[model samples]
Target: MKPKLLTLSLVSAITPITLLAEDVTTLPTITVEGERLPEPGISREKPEDMVGTPADAGDFLRDIPGVSGTRMGGHGIDPIIRGQSQTQLNILLDGAYVHGGCPNRMDPPTAYSPVETYDSVTVIKGSQTVIYGGGGSGGTVLFERKTPRLTEDKFIRGQVGGGYTTNSGTKELFGDVTAGSTQGFARGIIEYRDADNYEDGSGNETRSAHTSQTGNLILGYTPNDKTRLELGLEANRTEDVLYSGAGMDSPQADNDTIRLKYENQWGTKADVYYSDVEHVMDNYSLRSLTAPMKMRVPSKSKTQGGRISHNLLMDNEMEWTMGFDYQHNNRDANRFAGPPNMPTPTMLQSIMWPDVDLTQIGMFGEMQMPVRDIHILKMGLRYDRVTSEANRAGQAAMGGVTPNRLYQQYYGKNADVVDENNIGGFI
Candidate 1:
């Protein structure tokens, strides 16, 4: 076995790729009469590409069958892949979980990370392979960050663009730069966007217009021909919107992440890898709601994890990949339930430690065999030990006689026990 180790998100064993325009859908070049327009507006000057992130990622998924999304406010609608959301499916950032903010179908996972960060996004429509890890009963979406490789020129290049809508008449921008030599290189990207309240197709104004900002950076180094090392950072934030039910609208947001990854190959035939990621999300109260509703709901979360894997080439037409991965997700959120018109200007506070921790340890292996030059077979299997827990933080009643706080909320009154379990299955 030559050293050729590999890595990926515990949920989406991602490999390097060149994002090609090949899918299950295709039309004959000859056509019915002559070589003409290919399916309407798709021009040869501009190759067809998938659209992900910014909520409109589903447009890229059109090649897949039975997928749709309900209109939220702006950006695009949330992805509705074969009638499933969140739990039924698994969403990965650079291949890991970014866990969304809304539960009622607003703010999809792809919205957490920008699309330009990855070379490609792998969408598995079903329980495909345990080697990619489990939990994707509905399916899995891997928003990947490409493996780093510096060019010989040692130069930096980037691009920026923006667009507007008929209703909200929005403004947005995107740009990134990459530069390095054969030894090491680094890249970074930034995004800024905003929109005013938009009217429905019928001219009815919807208060859902909002604003968002995001930034990303990546660093890579190569010591030899077989192994490599890389690091990354990303930050995102969003303001308020009228719709998208999550009890309270966002006034301020702080979402930042950091990642460190290392890859080492023994020879051309063997490999080793180590990668870790940390993510954070925070929400602040809004002024409009505080004055009238006297309501406040703030929450924060942090998730960090690491993984390692090895690869083996059995022969020219057969290959095997094996590895183990571990991850943990935790959060602290505040929920408010108060007032029946008025309690004589009284104040009450209920706080629950909505914090939860999930950890998974697993070993997986994959085998691929080529039955023919054009036909091949692929399979993978794994076993995982996963556990989850939730503990009550506390609760208290506070008042200033005249009610300094119009209204306040708390969390975990249910004495929520940690939902812990061990699980394993196909990818």
Candidate 2:
């Protein structure tokens, strides 16, 4: 079954009625207007052109139509597009995927993406294409950086800036630099942000504070004008993040990513990436020790993916794109509890994520043809194979109870490996 959403708003206007000696002759007609209809297809915009400074990709996406976000804390705002969120939406960072380590979604994909570091952000609403992957029923968001072109006249380019928000005492500093000749170029970026708890308009304080730092480097080799190869490395670290909406505060959340990409003038492209994330959250580290016992959870996630595609143009002005993509994700998390004021907790409270692994492989083909004057037709077909397994489902945890046993007790189902094959198409 598909999910649905409904929203309603009410507005009231009070106007004084004036009494006059003469009788009323005519009354003016009133018309009410609603929001404009969303436009179809893709929307791309330069990050520098965006109004105001955005803390992360989620803040940047709020400017786009049909996009909204849920604020978790001072940082990490989860984005929702066209009422679709989480796994239903495909979020990509320079053709790579980064999964958050927090099981409660304190750190979504967008949380790691620094808006100013990228050249452009693209949003494709709805199921517009199949080349990006499968199950993006809601939409897709791509944060992309462009390759730098250097010449003898202008061999260096970059930007450095900083901003501050008074209400929250939020401070940010960022820098981007690139240098090289026509054959190759090297780029580097660094960003740092620190924020304190903020107060609402009514002067109520919210427990939202965080500190984050990010570093990225890219080396591009352009042997010829038609061919380009690039390697990218990135790291993000967040510490002492406090959240008002969640039970625990994050002490450390870190991410590391590496990617390689190749493209040619012939419309051939290839990309491969690997990402790792580590997250730690505890109730005592950043907040008062109100509970009788100290609780903490540490989780880790890893993702590896690649894609290869080619575009072809026919004599009839029709375009065809075909591609294959594969992705594998692994996650493990554990919760621990001990007496209050205990620095290190050894007791195993629960197996939050019992070493789960998910893999998906997909192949897709799409065609766009010009039918006649002012008319066009597009179609696409995709097939995907998915496999999932919990390697430690039977491992004992918390009173010698296994995850599989808990699953059986709660849902009355066996925790066994599963596989699925899916086919999707659009016209």
Candidate 3:
């Protein structure tokens, strides 16, 4: 009886093995189900297909509903979403911040971004979440890059393309390359565009000649299949950006960015980034300095921020996500002046930006639960603390009155700083 029991146990174990070994056509099937978030008023675009459109960043927004742009020339058009533009709308490049340099809105944040280099552009209308930085009253545009998984086989991938437009003699050249093994990967991208002035329908030449170039490099490491760490560097330059409707042309605009990110299958993610932008726009560089209203304004902006977020899965039926984010920005400006009557130029150096500083900190959380087979419940809450201040109280040399005096006359005294606390939620 003992021998028979041992034989029966061995046969049972070996029977399944023999069945699996003989199986050649039968295999297990896998089905994956997905659900969309309940958030509304969100729009997304894939910019790679937009290469056929104009080379400017504003060109991509033309197809999106409820979005428009202010055309100053043939290039560097500022985007307006639902009648909101400039600082009113938050523009982020890979979760980083950059400020425009032109006071007349000549060089918007979009101008600094290379549309071809990004994979996704997400637009959220109105105040949505505090996971990102604050002051997104009008909306938010997030430019994102997705990293590909490393394969077991070592290989390289790349794309090269170019295009030309006859209307303005515009030319664009772009290339993307990636090389990797199962453990690590590296990628690089470059996009360059140059265009001459384009003629209106009436055959009149417009002041829109421009040249721009951007480069980005990323290095990533994967210790396991479920975790990834990455570092990214980017540099962008735009030269000869002409604005016909505005008073000055941007001779040189330079931007630098650095980013670090980490993610794991445990639903934890983090990002740290910094960006710096310097802009030099003068009438003399692109137009005549001897003109009656010759002016030059050079400005620099520095921004740094970071965010850490986690996803908590509860009982396989619900998900909760919470995060904290903070951002700081500093801006300084100095203006140079000259005219046909003056032999020497005088600088209104201290007054352009007045050394502005903006700081914001926020905490946010969201929860999603499956109420039934076909229904879901979603809720979110966020709180933000924002502060804005200016160091200089005086006005430019060209102005007859000071900014502090004007503010005091209108609002009252001791209005030098603004502090605000906001709490928002949705269900």
Candidate number with greatest lDDT: 2
Candidates 2 and 3 compared: the better one by TM-score is 2
User: In candidate 3, where is summed lDDT lowest over 10 consecutive residues?
Assistant: 341-350
Which residue runs of candidate 2 sit more than 4 Å off their true CA positions?
1-39
Candidate 2's error at 171, in angstroms?
Answer: 0.9
Q: Per-residue lDDT for 179-297 in model 3, tens only? A: 98878889999999999988999999888889999999999997777798989999999888887887778888899999999989999999999989899877776876656655778
| Cα lDDT tens digits for candidate 1, 1-427 | 2233323342244322323334346766874566643422111111015432243354444445545556555543566556775567776676455655433334555555555445566676666655555566666666666544666764566666665665676776777678877787788878777877777689887666667788888887876655777777778776664454344455554567777767678412211222222222112232233333344445555566655666676658687777777766665554443443542222334332345566667777777777776555777777777776654333333432111122222332334344444454542
RMSD to native for every prediction?
17.1, 14.8, 11.0
* Cα distance off (Å), candidate 2, residue 292: 1.8
Per-residue lDDT tens digits of candidate 2, residues 1-427?
1222222211112112233434577979989999654446678879888776676889889888789999878789998888989898999999999999999999999989989889999999889889888999988899998866788899899899988888889998999999999999999999999999999999999988899999999999987787889999999999999999989999999999999999999999999999999999999989998889899999999999999999999999999999999999999999999998679777998898999999999999999998886667989999999999999898898799889899999999867999999999788
lDDT per prediction?
0.55, 0.90, 0.80
Candidate 3: clashing pairs of residues: none
List where candidate 3 sits over 4 angstroms from the true fold: 1-40, 289-293, 341-346, 371-376, 394-401, 409-415
Question: Which 10 consecutive positions of candidate 1 have the poorest summed lDDT?
Answer: 39-48
Candidates in order, TM-scores: namely 0.71, 0.89, 0.84
- Please tell me which predicted candidate would have the highest TM-score against the true structure: 2
